[model samples]
Target: MTPTRRGPKKIDYVGAQSDGTKLAADLPAAVQVPDDAVAWTAVLGESTVRNLHSPDWKTREHALQAVMRSLGNARWNAERSPEDVWNTVTQLLDKALKDKVAPLYYASLELLSTLVATYSPNLPYGVLTQGLEPLMPTLLHRVGNNNARIQETSIQALLTLANQPALGLAFLAPHALSAIPKKSQSGAAAAIQMSGRLELITCMLNVQVQQQMGFGTAGRTPAAAAAAGKGGDALMAEDVVRFTRPALDMPDDKVRTAAVRLVAEVYRTRKAAGQPFEVEKMVGAGLKPALMQRLA
Candidate 1:
């Protein structure tokens, strides 16, 4: 009789020492960091926040980087809760977001995304609701800014929130997308109501539609989960954000046209979702003329 072949057995992955002994983690029964270490970490966190508000862009950028690093460190984070750190830095974060300087905005966005990505497990679960959800409106508003750094970082920050199953699928998903159009403004002889618009439509794709493997588990609705399964191909409408105005003042027709396409896609999706849209009401709205001229 022919002998049946068997596949090799799988073994548990273990690091081996030079002596061929399996290595084990050298963890103490409990972390016993000294009082001075904790106090110093708190000081470092405070100093970093101070640097973020410095007048010099270099100083601001360096501070943001420092905050990002300190938040990501395991021992440092253990010393100070993420919520405490975030509360202390909230004002600085707000300033960074509002700063017209591209680098400051980019660093702020990166800092938020980096924290969720790096410290999700080590930090408390409340950061999602307490630390992140409160910042959603500001993040959504910035998504419409024409500046590349602001736009991309906004998208990245949103995606990071979407990845958290602990916060539930609705933490940062389609259910949360909504905004009112900025009222039209007049000329130099008249008061301007609202002049700012957008040239930005980065992506509605939520790459962070990932699985929940943490403490406070949160999952998406069936529809949201189904849409997420399609990944990048998910219709941009799957995650809609109301646009207050168009971003088409750019001289380059190619750029304007691209912006128009983004707006058209967004408008179509927004309508399908039954959300309010006033871009068509604005005469200078970039999406309007682009669509009309093409039809004519």
Candidate 2:
């Protein structure tokens, strides 16, 4: 028999270069920073910023990211003027607002957050009042996104906006207020109360009472109010009293415990502010025996 023709031995291809450089090779090119980037003269030249909004997604993203990074760097360096960055940022934000793409929407929020953190001095109050106002409704609608990063970023952006009193009030207007309680129930009640979302404050207080009484999550009542800071303390005491009274009456040990915590926080807040303590009276009227025994 002809020397048996053997199939070629399959060589196991382990070699010094086994690690794949192919992925690196296949990666997209790094975005080019135009020579004029970050130059105030070039940035403000007529039609400079407008060109940044061209249909190229990568370009828009690069421009926004570069502007944010430069703003941060300038803030750190203290060498660059803020006015230039502010103008460019506002122009980029305008472009982002006009774009219908989801990525651009999300990027606009990121840019806004950076603007808030870095260039508040240069950013006009009117810009925050008008330009940023419309974005909140859009963001509130996206809070349920399966992307946790997006959800968290949106909440953080809202929180950042709320740090300013005027913007905070604008944010609490009906539409944004409606989104807080829809979050996962685990933190929903606490977040609503802490956010000073008065519309849902009573409901959250009741939940906190339930939790404190061992009916639900424990120790969340005062914790929620404390998280709200002074803004929450300003919520009418009558509302707090109204919500906690039923829990004060419940025979359930956990409910009683929770109610006591809620009432105490209200009274504490009022006392701290040198205001009348009305929550106790409401509790007494609604659950006389329980208040006398538990809260007294």
Clashing residue pairs, backbone N/CA/C < 3 A, model 2:
213-254, 213-255, 213-258, 214-254
Report the lDDT tens digits of candidate 1 across residue range 181-284. 23222232111111111222233322322232223333343443443453322323423323322325544455455545655656654565577546544324
Off by over 4 Å in 2: 1-51, 73-91, 94-106, 121-124, 164-175, 178-296
Model 2 agreement with the true structure over 199-244: per-residue lDDT tens digits: 2333433433343345632222343233334233223567556655
Error of 2 at 39 (Å): 17
Best by TM-score: 1
Query: Cα RMSD for candidate 1?
Result: 18.1
**Where is model 1 more than 4 Å wrong at Cα?**
1-46, 122-127, 174-176, 181-296
lDDT of each: 0.47, 0.47
Per-model C-alpha RMSD: 18.1, 15.8
Per-model TM-score on C-alpha atoms: 0.50, 0.41
RMSD (Cα, Å) of model 2? 15.8
